[model samples]
Target: MTPSQRTLLWVYAAIIAMWPIRHLAIWFIFRKLDILTPDSPRLTMDHPPLVTAIIPAKDEEGTLAECLASVCAQAYPNLEIIVVDDRSTDRTGQIAREFATADPRIEVLTIEHLPPGWTGKTHAAQQAADRARGDWFWFLDADTRHSPENLEIVMEYARDRGAALTSLLPEMRCETFWENVVQPLAGIVLMQSYPLFRVNNDRSSLAFANGQYILIKRSAYEAAGGHHAVRDRFVEDIRLAARVKALGLPIRVAIAREIGSTRMYASLDQLVRGWSRILYDALGRNPWRLLGRLLDPLIFSQTGHVAFVVALFLLARGHTSPFAFWLLGLSVVHHIFTYTVLARVYHMSVPRSRYVAWFPVANLVMDVILIRAIKMCLTGRVTWRGTAYGPTVTSSTRPVTKPVSPN
Candidate 1:
């Protein structure tokens, strides 16, 4: 081989070596991390502060009843639930009303019109917070199911940590084959971008949260401008967390695998659209950062697969060498080890991790979604909950009002 080609081969080998080392370090970090549960002694019922739970619903009739039921069953004593029915064509409003009628603490608000510049979910959350009368405001999605002690546990954790904001990364419940494969990949990407350890550290500016379960002090919420502060952003959860961190307030994030679970999407199509709406904005509005974020995964995590492909191509062309063979072996081993670590971190079963051979395919699917999302964001054609939003039309220039519904 030429000198240039030999140098390139050495670089490839170096890249392959780094993959396992990086993942091994990550696995060690994850093992040392703590996951929160409802049974912890730190969580107690003593003088529990009043909390208001806000849920935003739009065409969520199928999951509304169960979600509301879970919220109503919280072990915390002083709690109120508000369900915002944001122009649902389904029976979301009816299901909410049934809950309200049976429980005095539950109230239903119907929103008919989405104000200009505000995303539907943020708008609904803002309205519910305005009507809330509690020391803490809990924002939850309609699709999440909480354990009976979830609220009590999270509230106590926040108070003990002296945190102004707290959010939990719910255990992802995946039933379908695609869900199992793709969900783990998504989690890897998210964790890599925002390391949990750094996010939990008060000194670090990095902040992240799952919108499925977020609890913030009412004062902090208002001081940070609430959902209205991130009214135009697609990933409001992370943005709000950043806002809290920017103000030098303490924010805690932990794994809630046992405390609560959420099935983000029921099918593949829904999953694609849901993540597309998030990845584009979460990476940033800058084109260079978006491209870097998209390429980083392929280079860092999927290097083994890429090397394997290149080795096969060289062999097919009747060009073979010891370096190429060594690269292939190292790449395959690295890929297997990386996937094994990921399965353990995500709590996947043994048989599931054995499907590590499909890692390349999964990475390809994710890359496609990222590219499509970037294109949509650039074109201002991103759609969520049957509403199309543009980049330029995000400021709330008009006043928001609640719709009167005869229920």
Candidate 2:
């Protein structure tokens, strides 16, 4: 090969290699990210703040009991638990009522109908907040299971940082084969997409929070207009965080793997819809970004590298070119490094060979999630908890309603 031709080929290879390098950088960022562990923050509050744990449920019969039990197990004293049964057709309300009967700290609220222009969860959360008498509103999803120290450690972290809103990065609990593979890769995509560093930066406008576990001081929650301000938002947690941060309130996102764990979906069907809604709303319904995100699984993630290695392996087996063999070796090394880092990020340990063997199938599932999300975004509506909502919902300005007696 001529000198100029060789130089041109090298340039092309470098350009193609940038994608994998970018993925590595994202994983490294997560590896060094802050973790709020069990033994963190030695300082103790003289008088512990009253924290109200609010959970909004809509047909969450399967997980409601465990969720309530976890919150009730919190080591922190001066705690209140509110569970809103928002038009659940299942045994969700019955289970919640059972908990409320057994524990004086637990309160259950039932809503007969969802007021127009508010997402069901947001509306339910607002109801719980309205009746909460705690100094802080600790929003926990019904699907999440928390460790005893979950509340205490986060409380200290927020107090030390003087943060108004705190979003905990929970340990994602995966059970099924699809859950094991797709969830971790999805977490990697979300972390990179949101960039927790930017979200937590005081000056950065970027803000994000996981709905599964968000702790907000009552004053800050009120200042940011609470859920009422973001009632129409499908991705209310993120919207609430943005509002808080925009108001110059300090927000913190931490690694809380020891504190809490959440299993987001029960099946592949739920997984697709759940992630699709998040991606569509989180990306601000931008088609171009959605398209790129759809392709990320196949191009920029470890799955992309895994596929590349397989392709190059096949080529190198028969090709006489030394470049093919060298490229194959490099790609294999990159995949191994990324795979290990991703496992560490999730606090999960799995055999690399097993993961790689199923990587391609999982990658396709991820793509389907983004694709469905894009279509939903373009269509300007999506369904949640069996309710269909437009791209946006708007409500008349109103004060928090007084709590009604549980049915």
Candidate 3:
């Protein structure tokens, strides 16, 4: 090999060396949160707060009914369900209105138009909050389903921790081939990057929240200006969490594998489009940083597999010594260990978890998707909820000039 090639190989080797350190950091951090426990309680049930569950949906007819049904079945008694349908062309608005008419606690609101510099969904959520009568607000997506005890558990968790804002990272339901193979891997990558335990406690600027299931106190929501404050953010959940953190409000997040679940994207096209919508926002408009952040897991998995194959080839050719064989075994063992732990912590099944065994192959396939996402973000071509959004969403990120008061 030439000198340049040798240097590249060394660079690859260094990347491999760092993988275990990153994995260990994630494992140790999540281990504190007790993520493996299916029913770990973060709070007591006796003092659960009155909560309003709000869903801002657009054309979610297929999932809206089941989602509302789940909210109505909450174990917590002091609850209200408010569904804001944002100009849905489907029966989403009709279904929500029917449910509202049937139940005194449920109310349906039909939003007219999305104003400029406002995220379509957040505009609806802000309107829902205006009509909410509860002391706490829970924002959930239409695709999300909850277990009966979610509200009771989450409310108690907020009270015990004195958290103004709390969100649950639910176990994603993966049924389709793309959903099963690729979707769970996204969860794995997220867990690895931001350890849940550290994120909950450490008072760092690095804040993240899953929009699927968020529970926030009304006072805190108003204090931080609620969804109005982040009206235009594509990733409003995380932006609101960041604002809460910036204002020094207490924040808490819990693993909610048993409390709730969601099927975010059904097909490969959906996955790519959905992920692209916020990938740029998630990257904070930095292409190089985004590339670096995405490259780690891909390179790490590929290197381990390549190392094992080469070592095996050498051994079969009688060119490998005991140390070479040991190296190959150690690499494979470490990959298995990390992947297994990641899958288990993220609530994937045993067989599906074994898909990590094909990390090398999977990484190769995902790189194409990541590249496409980056291109979409860079080109300012993102579409969500039947509307196209431009790059960066600068206008939405601007704080509202007028303060909003609770109703």
Question: Which whole-number lDDT from 0 to 100 does residue 238 have in model 3?
Answer: 82
Mind sharing the TM-score for model 2? Answer: 0.87
Error of 2 at 57 (Å): 0.8
> Local distance difference test, per candidate?
0.79, 0.78, 0.71
Q: Which of the predicted structures, 1 or 2, would earn the higher lDDT when compared with the native?
A: 1
| Residue pairs in clash, model 1 | none
lDDT of 3 by residue, 1-407 (tens): 35664565566556556656756765676567723233645445565567899998899998888898989887677787888878789998788877877777887777766666677878888988998888889999999998887776776677767788888877677777677667666555444445567668746666778788788878888888888999867778888888887788877777666667788888887876676565656656556656875787656666667777877887888865655566576667657755755556434422334455555555654676567666765786667878766744443332221212212
lDDT tens per residue, model 2, 1-407? 35664574465455456656666776667675678777786336678888999999999999999999989888887898888888889999889888887888888888877777788888989888988999999998999998888888888888888899998877777778777777766666566578877877788899999998899999999999999999877789999999999889999988764667888986888888888888887888787888987765555454446546665776857864655555565566556655555555445422222454466567788788888888986798888788878745443444233343433
Off by over 4 Å in 3: 1-15, 34-49, 191-193, 306-354, 391-407
Clashing pairs in 2: none
Best by TM-score: 1
Error of 1 at 23 (Å): 2.7
What tens digits encode model 1's per-residue C-alpha lDDT throughout 1-407?
A: 66776786777667667756776787676775657776664456567778999999999998989899999998788998888998899999888888888888888888887878788899899999999998999999998899998887888788888899999888887777677777767666656777778888888999987788899999999989999999988889999999989999999887775778888887878877887777777776545565776787777677766788888887788778776676677677767776666667556312234445566666777887787777875787678888878865553545445543323
